[model samples]
Target chain A: DAGVTQSPTHLIKTRGQQVTLRCSPKSGHDTVSWYQQALGQGPQFIFQYYEEEERQRGNFPDRFSGHQFPNYSSELNVNALLLGDSALYLCASSPGGWNEKLFFGSGTQLSVL
Target chain B: DQQVKQNSPSLSVQEGRISILNCDYTNSMFDYFLWYKKYPAEGPTFLISISSIKDKNEDGRFTVFLNKSAKHLSLHIVPSQPGDSAVYFCAATYNTDKLIFGTGTRLQVFP
Candidate 1:
């Protein structure tokens, strides 16, 4: 069984630009959650998607949004990137319904210059 | 406000010794806690978890202990090995989907 997979292992964007990161969940999983890990910090919750709908969100602003497709894949979009946006964006998936353990992808390293 | 805190930025232990990593959370509402291990360039991998109802949970060489009164949790690795060296994060949730993670502690087991 393939684990969670993310696209564009690395990305570069300038201020005021936008970027999209993609994620494919593990087989048999239905929920996808996004997280941001800044340097010397733990992964911070961004939002979670379930059944093509957002189930919950964290303290992130409106500039950060996500979409979950029927296939269980997800996309995280960040608009008007700032220098602080530079971090490792991680995607994790679970089997849904109060499942606590999450399988995570290697993550995409985003650098806003 | 940082809800979850891992005060130790790094830890070092000799091989075969016990390694203890501590975490504390400010939210008393959190009922579930988990630990994850991450290597460089990789996402954090689930390690073990403990619920508020239980004080301790063990899985093979890894174990998790939670103290509800102190709002603190810890992860213990017995007979630590070099491969076990990685960044460890403790997270908690209040019966909700979103998890509040600590800053993480880098553990190195030297031979």
Candidate 2:
């Protein structure tokens, strides 16, 4: 069975531009979550989508938004990207809603130059 | 404000030695804690976890200890091997859906 898969292994974007990263969860998994890992830091939770709806969110601003499709895949969109937006965007999938072990994808490296 | 904190940025240990990475959180409501390991250019992988009900949980050479009173948790790797070297992150969840992570601790095991 394949693990979580993310698109565009690496990307480069300029300031004021918007970017969308995609994720397909692991087989038999239904929940999807997004995280941001800055250089030399741990992954920070962005939001979680379950049952095709956002179930929980972190302290991120409105510019960071996400959507979950019926098939349990997810997309993370960052608008008006800034230089600080450069980081590794990771997608994780789990079978249940809460306290479930997560399977993570290699992540998409976003570079705002 | 950083709720979860891993003071030590990096740790180095000789092979077959014990390595202990510490983490502390200011949030008392957090009841579930977990540790994840990450290699370069890879996503963080779940290592182990402990609920507030248990003070310790162990899996092979990996163990996680939770001290609720002190709001601290630790991951202990016994007989550390070179392959075990990676960045370790401490995460906590209050309601179990969203997790808050601390700055990771990079572990280097010398052969």
Candidate whose TM-score is highest: 1
Candidate 1 chain A, run of 10 with poorest lDDT: A94-103
Measured by lDDT, the strongest candidate is 1
Encode model 2's per-residue lDDT on A30-60: one tens digit a residue.
9999999998888888999999998988888
Structure candidate 2, residue pairs in collision: none
Listed per model in order, the count of residue pairs whose N, CA or C atoms clash below 3 Å is 0, 0
Q: Model 2, range B1-111, lDDT digits (tens) per residue?
A: 899999999999999999999999999998889999999888889999998999999999999999989989999999899999999999988877588889999999999
Tens-digit per-residue lDDT, B47-78, candidate 1 = 99998999999999999999889999999999
DockQ of each: 0.74, 0.72
Cα TM-score per model? 0.98, 0.97
lDDT by residue (A36-107, candidate 1, tens digit) is: 999988888899999999888988999999999999999999999999999999999998744389999999
